[model samples]
Target: MDERTRADVERAEAALVEHYPRLVRLTYLVLPPSTGRHRRVLTAHGLVQRALPRARLRRPDGGLPAQRGPAAEPGYDVVRLRALRLALAYEGRPLWGPAALPQVWGLRLFPRVGGAEELALDQALSAVPAPVRAALGLWHLEGLDEDAARSVLARAGVEEPDAAQRAAAQLDRETETGAAALLNSAEFDPCTVQTRPTDLLRRRQRVRAALALVAVLAVGGAAAGLLSGDGDRTGRPPTTAEQALDPGRLLRTPNEAWTDTSRVDFTAWPVRGRQAGDRELLGRALRVWAAPPADARIMTSAGTSTRPPDHPPQLLYAGQIDAVTVVVFYDGERLVRYAEPEGATPTLHFARVDDADLTSGAALVIGRGNGWMRYLLAPWVSDVGVRDLLAPAGPVHGLHVTPDAVTDRIPVPPEGGTGCGHWPAAQFRPSTRIAGTGVNPPFLLTDLNDLVPVHLTSVPPGGAPAARAGEATGTPALQGWARTACSLGTLRGAGVRSVDNWAFAGQRLPEDSGSATWVCSRADTWRGPGSVTLHFLPPTTRPAEPGRIAGRARDTAACSSFGAPVVGNVHWRAQSGKWYLLAAGSHGVGGIDATGGVRVSGHTNTLAAPAGRNAPDEVVGRLRSGGTVRALRP
Candidate 1:
């Protein structure tokens, strides 16, 4: 053999050995999932193992070219392209020969089961066409850009490579997850798989009775066909009830139902949009919900189901919100919003609100575009206003609303930054009857990139009674929120239903220093588990200076009513240049204790002990009710 051919062979061999597991994983992700887990595992290993050059280096042909860009290692790229092509070919048609090498018998092999997020992503990827799946695998698993993905697809013999890439991109946008993150999960990793013994006894019995079972099945099939007489010629079952497509059958409440209905939830929201009676619009929306088109973008909040409603849904509102045609529907369990922009693909969003209440169901973000958002208020809403959470004393600007209850566009807050200059929150007052008093208490709602906005409430310091939503508008409450509103960005897309900021403790600093306050913010999501964060707001005159995040915990109920009291500590240096450890807890916390590098205890909910900068310790709060609550980890 020529020296060049020998070198090519050696390079290919080296690459195959070094990146075997990664290449196998890539092929497994690219292959169609219909092959089942056992066969997919074996096939992926077989394809990747045979990816190296055979004996000689033939001229690079029209086959998949070496990938460029980030994964531009010549040898690795060559083998990856070969393995990818083989997987795609296998997806087009079943392998004709005997089972590939690395086969196992009498055992079922499959990857470990992943969490809900991974399962959802797997199902989504499996729904797309094989070529599109390959494109996604390239873009995410291989970390390639659109251009690079298109090039790889074209070289791999995809007829419409650009279309495949576009479809993959559309799916990525709809799923709202980084494909790489899901692909790296154990659900797709075939190398480390779980094994289960096959039903060997059942298999043997099946083998013996195969012919007899087939004969009986053939006779039964003939009898059933003769009796059925052309059942469902379309070959696809109906996704929704018969009346779901009939727009006239949609349930609608009267415009003034809220005044008399005992139920104060969305059940009383009157259908009051300009296009509420547009059958064509309503029919299209229902059809998309039943079976979304290939090009439509669909989004579902975590834990929200994507199934169509079993019965005709209630029509809450159907009208133009901003520049898009919007349709809102409510089944008993889920809230679905459909938005279509002019000359653009439509989007369908679903959020679970089965537990929505008077305060949580007050407002919904109906439209968002070009850095602005619009809200659809409930029938009980009497007035709408906008407040800048950052400027506690700023005037609450009045927002104009159409006759149909759709508010004008309000600018969205910037996503993330240290300098939270402005954060806009919607403030609306419910009818006095709904409030059950002479005063129409105003409620606060902020858009967190979900169909329903999150309710914002606050509690004053010094164990004062927890106030209603209106009291959160007070200067002290607003200032406290201003110091922590930016932190709310972390809760975006987390299916959060409401957030409560409780200023649970106030402590005097040693050496005549100014006081400090400890606020525990708990975000409760629609799905059960929520998050808790503790903030340390030092005495500051500048409102823009945000507080420090002292501690945080996930899936915790601390700081919420009836939950464990939250405790946290931070080492602070007073203006006098002396450092000390300060700890505090929620109301009912009988005492505080610090362990590890520093040991200290207090008879009250607050504790102060001198310590150095590097003092490491764990703090626990002892409840007056004979229980202990640990501080959240930083």
Candidate 2:
């Protein structure tokens, strides 16, 4: 072509190359590693390779075919948006299966996290709703601003700029709280040029199977791999940190994040093989239950040092599943649960050791579920050293043992749900993206830990559901609210009432339905103690209406001693016909006067802090005899 065209192409290619890594990561966020029905289509590396050519070449080159109506060279936002659209359109669905929801909504929910586990990029994205996922993929992962993110979502079929704005705001909250670390840590490995995706799939499977086989054999009896394997040979033996490779280093200890043990009901648990050394039994467990390749290593070691010498050592089963390195924990022949560390390397703690203790390695693994630390330790390893390395150096917590457990492996239901209800959203396909291709309402943002259902018997004009009599019931429901209260500091000294603290909670309210139940725990607002629940009904798009807001605050411990109950009415401001929840203390923390002015008390107990614009429809407010009021959002 002409020299000018050639120059434009060159500049475009350079920009593409410079942004290639981010592009790959973005594409991966839109489509992540999975073994579900969409596996063949959601080829992240492949999609990026294909979409790179369509990005606005240069600031001066104008838009590509997918991007028209743009004047000068479309910015990187346009390019990234195009790439996302391309990825979503792949294989006709981002994910597949009867349950797969558009925008990856069909997966298990990832509610608010409380610092126990470190989620990988894919895992984190899997927890987010699809629209929010897309918005975040643009904002955080792709580095787009709110306006640009709104534009990108618009192009990708999200009609409401306000919704995109809400998603962007939520992302900001997540990043501020370190919730987005997993997405930040996610990386996209370069894909070699290939003609077909099947080839890549076959190669990937074969490699995983081979490694798994080796790992199984090594854990079973062979120690050759550990001694000769490539690791830091800088003459110094590797410390726990040094030995922890990617995935492992990135992984939190069993006690860290949400472990599989968190969701299980031990009463009905199923058992696996009887003893530890039963190669056939262990192998079968690995193959079917652990879902590892036949050859992955299996090193069964008896517990020592930190535990009763006679107690069975925890069996460390290391292998590859779906190209990911994972270590499964077992009690005797029973498969308790499994963990996936990030990389391909074997964990030093779980690595197969040579020489003595072969008998212990083959002995039946046992545990009282006192705590995983003691059971997980290797024979020769020092308990103190490893514990100090794995956890923040401090007083050791006793092993969290499961007692009187009847069965072995947790049962996997028809939907592939391991008795543990929590599944990686990526792995579990749900349905299509919510409010498809339209200006859908923003999803209600409640505590990820809150499981209280918004009873749907009735809803007002803004998509918020009315609370039912039994909206908050069940162990999980209480645990959800308790965790949320704990996070918000309402239960500062009260702590979560139960161990099942967090899980995904939130709702996609219907368009035209206004009003929802919001609970502002004293902890969330840092306003003394206890929590208040209220029905938040913002003014309708048509006209402003005076609505009475009411709620109750309970379970408040220490803060209950605060003098005089705080009082306030919920209020909203109308802008462009859309109502926004006026956060408590926003109007200068005062009681609203006849002229609609607010008055603040020197020491008021408002249940909520001021919620910003784009706040959820429902919010909780506390009012006292003085007519002073404070409100918070769900």
Candidate 3:
């Protein structure tokens, strides 16, 4: 194994070759047209990347943490936007926050946003289908290649790969026409893109950026353990900005993201769990939804807010990160969800508290079909695997209705399906890294939110404290509770692991895939998200074999001015904020994960940014065995 160089390209290529399959997948959201064979393939490519979550790139001295922007220090806003895009792309659907797609796409559609409970959509061209929104986002905002764009579409649907290829061509032609309108629209300009009023993306980015970071920081101890635990200060700020955008925030009371009292029929829904109302949850869900999913402190005060009775009320429930049971009862003590948050126990307080009246676990929720249905969104009432990504809905784990309605756990069908149609790419896994390694076709995966499946089962039921229950010897031993699904055993300890591999596993410190030792302990939900701190030992072995090609290069559409020098074989995600230019075969730096997902070598990059103010846009320089990296422009 050897090292990788650290520098960006003189310019990036816009062609399919230039864009990494993962990046193409993200951009395909903006791809003008996604019916081509190219789009289909790109969709497939993206799906793979999402599942794999790794993007191979050259490292100069060592690897740099992935950034949001293309400069030594990227604009905070930019990184926030990119992260949101990634989250939304989890299920191949464009999960919108506060920000709108680039002005051009918005221009194509008319505005459908209204006051309170108002959603931001385009009426310009009927409502842009979820697919079109994703395409437009990738193409217009992310700027992916033609053929690459098609790859992403393939994941969504496009049984015929050949047709997907043709659609990419048509999409490009449509893009050119929209480009002119975009430049004239408010979005093309930086000022408007950043500061303009009336625009949602820019505004949402402000709030969403901050909130996103907060949520990430708020969740359970494992979340806290892995995220902002050690004072391993890179001197970098905790977050560039708050995730100011929360599309649901614009709703009347900020809790409008949920339907007041709608019947979410799970008789046929997958991974059953009733939604916790906005008000009933008190403000807990709002805060949690805005913040990260784990490492949250269940504070009585946090869920104690009140609301009017007739006013739209929100509901909430208590459960594990994997599954949260929804119970809407109105007893004397459980007036506001907050008061009863501590219903049976203390840790199990109001998942959300509000100023409303509530009662027993058995409550009535009126609806059209069932007229009156008992709403108990319990977690994993029936244990269903949540990994199937491409399905419209996964299997219904538990279908326990009263004997009269539907009861008993749905038997785990022996033949892998529930008579539900096959999901286009249920098993597709996309790499988290966007620009690195050879360009694979795009593919869609499950929604990031979907990853938060309502898993049920008695893993220390009653949300009991793990330490006291003695249920801490399993794969994920926790003092109180362990982060769901993710156990060091599965990816690190002898269970199909990798070393220094961010390509598949998450971007943890050191990122060692095999024999990767990380500390997972319960942390305080209130003070710090948790006490779990995952530490990857500096690799003693190199990650990749010598001469193993990595990194990326593309035309200008993805990077700079139109027709800029074709930046080829450049590095991928060297730095977060800055983009720089470097020549290939400079010198290998940092580390790489050896094949078979086991072994690691090299170190993180330590090169200086080439571009003066915002250099290092592209890190992961393509260096040789023993070469030194030099500035291309300088």
Candidate 4:
């Protein structure tokens, strides 16, 4: 009505008309996808058209502050604020009402179909809450920084705008082309859309079906009420135990069956626990496995399924260890372990060992507490010993076991430390039948945060045959492992099935320095590609120190049974106080070359050249076939 107010209204109207398409696109991106595409297009346009008056009449005390930077124009900022607020308010509410404006009839309008990337972006946006989508659109499509987006979100009535901004940034990082490119694609453009006719025949058929189903349900409800007796009528689903089979029906193997069976896997293990026959405790374990309680702690290895077994599972053990009740079950595909303390909630763990062999299925950690772990050995394990991997010549100590085949608590090995103190590993010798030979050698196994322990073995330095489980006990193999054992800490919680250390290359230093050995340690995991690490062991003078890491890679086939060549380089300081560049490769490599800071080449699998400290260089290995392979970096 007043002159000043009239001029402000005109300016706001002009801004709305000039930026109509951009505002509609922003609202369309921020609007929840649950509003079917046809309705969304019309709603976005209607909201922007109505934003001009709301901006002009906004209350001074509650209105949004003017936007900063390029969007700081008096009219554009107010109009954008009003439009964004209106779009956000549409979430979780009906898209259209009887008196709602801009309604379309007998037609469906939706954006054009896009490529796979656009479809993936659309689905990702739909998975998040509406406020997060708003932040993404403002920060990406509108080109606003994170701080500016947060301010806009706060003024538009989001309770936790900072959290939304963080979520948007994470989502952007996950996408291949970023959210900005996908939001700008034609797949989300409302102005460029395809049209289709409404399906009247399907609508009529759905109405009739709904009416008939309602009438049938009404009649069925009356008949059920007449047959029901008076009792607690609260309608709640059955509990987890009530839905599963009774504990009495669980499958159990005979105590002596393992002796005669040819299979050496978990199926041969007999029930050997003090509480093996407790039906009440078994029932509680079954319920927790079926549907864990809210307070229950759960852990699973990579690619393991959490679904409960469909049939009755076989019980392997149910016992008390360290004042805690532990239960073990095998469902043919998974090995499930459940532990419950006296006054604390239970913990459920699942691991996938469908392809486990005799060496891998020999032991499982049954209990762990106070920096110690107890293992349940196979029924055929006749002897158990603990060995310190860091001390090759240290005597092996005998480990005591109970009649149930569970060993006494053994100190857990140190994950990593400033010094190579000690690393404990379990050694097991099987019975004559399981060993299949007159002479039985002990197998070495170590826990790596999984249900089944990983087997540790080694290949001798001079290309001796690949060592079996027991062959790693030789003097040469043990000495090599003493220097390589500390590096195994990196494989913790990696789902590794086994690790083999190969003393592949040994090279004499260039300037009268002592010989150094190159050990390629490859960890084979249960899922995905295995990890490979090249370790550089200095001369014998530094026996107290662990091998220095030279190079590493993930998902590489080098140094495995397939015989792929691997190359690595390191900067070494000799006893003469001079630095040199040292490089080595596996057997198949015909030549090794180094470029950049130092230039050197060798026809054999090893090469060394004088260089400066921290000198940058690239190393490559050439095969007999003339193909080049890059070295794995540290």
TM-score per candidate, in order? 0.67, 0.34, 0.18, 0.66
- Candidate achieving higher TM-score, 2 or 3: 2
lDDT value, candidate 1, whole model? 0.78
Full candidate order by lDDT, most accurate first? 1, 4, 2, 3
lDDT of 4 at 405: 86
Give one digit per residue, the lDDT tens place, for model 3 in 1-634.
Answer: 2111222221122222343443433433333232322222333334323321122374433766434345442232232233324433434333233222222311112111121101111222123334544444445555556565456555445345345445433444544224323322332222211111122233334544765646534543332322222322455422311111211221121222122323221211122123432333433333332231222223221112122122222233322221323322222222222212333321222222112111111121211011111233222122112222122223322223541222222211122222222211111112222223233222211111110111111123222222232222222222111122122111110111011111111122211222222111221211111112122222224221111122222111211111111111222223354432222211133322121112222243322122333233432322335433321221
Clashing pairs in 4: none
Cα error, residue 576 of model 1, in Å, equals: 2.2
* Poorest lDDT segment (10 consecutive residues) of candidate 4: 223-232
Model 3: residues with Cα > 4 Å off, grouped in runs: 1-283, 290-407, 411-634
Better of 2 and 4 by TM-score: 4
Model 1 lDDT tens row, 28-115 = 8877787677778888888888777665345444544433334324777778878888888876567434425677754557776554
Q: What TM-score would you give candidate 4 relative to the actual structure?
A: 0.66
Candidate that beats the other on lDDT, 2 or 3, i.e. the better one: 2
Whole-structure CA lDDT of model 3: 0.26
* Model 1 regions more than 4 Å off: 1-240, 433-438, 464-471
Q: Which one wins on TM-score?
A: 1
lDDT of each: 0.78, 0.32, 0.26, 0.76
Weakest 10 consecutive residues of candidate 3 by summed lDDT: 493-502
